[model samples]
Target: MTEALEIRNLHVAIEDNEILKGVDLVVKQGEIHALMGPNGTGKSTLAKALLGHPDYEITAGEILFKGENIIEMDVDERARLGMFLAFQYPVAIPGVSVANFLRTAINAHRKAADPEDKGISIPDFRTLLKAKMDLLEMDHQFAGRYLNEGFSGGEKKRAEILQLATLEPAIAILDETDSGLDIDALRIVADGVNSLAGPDLGVLIITHYQRILNYIKPDFVHIMLDGRVAESGGPDLAEHLEEHGYNWLREKQSKATAG
Candidate 1:
């Protein structure tokens, strides 16, 4: 069977400045992989590139989803193919209600899959949205409010996870979901992710801190540095990073460069 997402020797640049230098990764269904790195190390760049963000140009390498190269696909095309990205900083749409936004997205996906379909009915959409909101422990009022408008940090993060739950993407890339969140908020977000993790979904969590891993244990841990993935290992690698920090990885990279 084809893998969920396979990135081979991926290279990305923005405005002629290369950010991701030959990144190779494979995420299979039912696995969670954490890409941990320091600030400005191209972690977020990698996430954006995978989602086909126009700003980050993919100068080289291939991104294959389910055995087909998606490097040339557009952002909406990729999303329609069951790939979802939860942004590090989610933008607010002042006039769009959360319920309407979700319904439109869900209907788009449905239409893409079956061109003959008329889209989800209002009654069915409400039931589905309510169930997803309950699963995420969000209030019904959240659905009626404008998307991410005037939401607190915790609320924003929760809203992102709610999108993930509602979309049910095959591969979900959460870029720094733990950023700007407190302990309680972090746990809630983690719980939301944990609930959705199963045989049908794969997750790529890009983060700089190991605190989130304490709740959402990853099956594999990777460390990116200087625009490349320097090391990869099991969950213990995250524990090591938590205890020591990135100094060891930096020293190792320095020696490799000097050699």
Candidate 2:
């Protein structure tokens, strides 16, 4: 099984502060991996760095996508190469409608898939948008509303998944998508994500709580502490963290690094 995205001894820093220290992971096609950790453990930083966030400096290591080293690839270049990240806090663009935003992004993905193929036609774009919106349970009016201008927490999260469905990226990093969602909303978002699961999509789910794991059921679970991945296991790891919390894992990680 080929990995969709593989991080090799990745070390990321911001300004003078190091965040991710020698982290390594792999998300193979059709696999869902959960990244669970306490805050400031570099989970979000890893997602941002993979997306080539400007503030993040890759001080060391490599990110390989489909056997290509993307350490120096620009953010847009990475997106064009079938990488997507669902931000924990989505941005609100007051003037751009959700429909327009999605259409542009889908077209961009299409253009990248085939540089010679022209963008999606307006009628065709609308049809595709309606189909995805229906899958997310978004109202038709949502298509005309400004991007997250007044969306509730759940709405924003679902909107992010909508984009994911439309883009169909090979690898997706979902950053705390369950942060503000109620149980009902979390289920909906998880369903939408699950609908996209197959032989082509690999997901990296980053979260602090395991409640969402109960809904999404990751195949592998990783515990991140301090500034690196401390331990990894099957879904049972999530249950263990939920029961005992991070204190023990933090201590274990500290002792391991100390030795």
Query: lDDT per prediction?
Result: 0.94, 0.91
lDDT of 1 by residue, 94-208 (tens): 9999999999999999999999989999999999999999998999999999999999999999999999999999999999999999999999999999999998899999999
Candidate 2 lDDT by residue in tens digits, 1-259:
5557999899999997998989999898899999999888899999999999999999999999989999889999899888999999999999999989888888787887798978999999999989998888888898899998999999999899998998888899999999999999999999999888888999999999888987898999998877777889999989989999999987886787799
Q: How does candidate 1 fare on TM-score?
A: 0.98
State residue 18's C-alpha deviation in candidate 1, in Å: 0.6
| lDDT measured at residue 121 in model 1 versus the true structure, 0 to 100 | 97
Maximum-TM-score candidate: 1
Worst 10 residues of 2 by lDDT: 248-257
- In model 2, pairs of residues that clash are none
- Clash counts for the predictions, in order: 0, 0
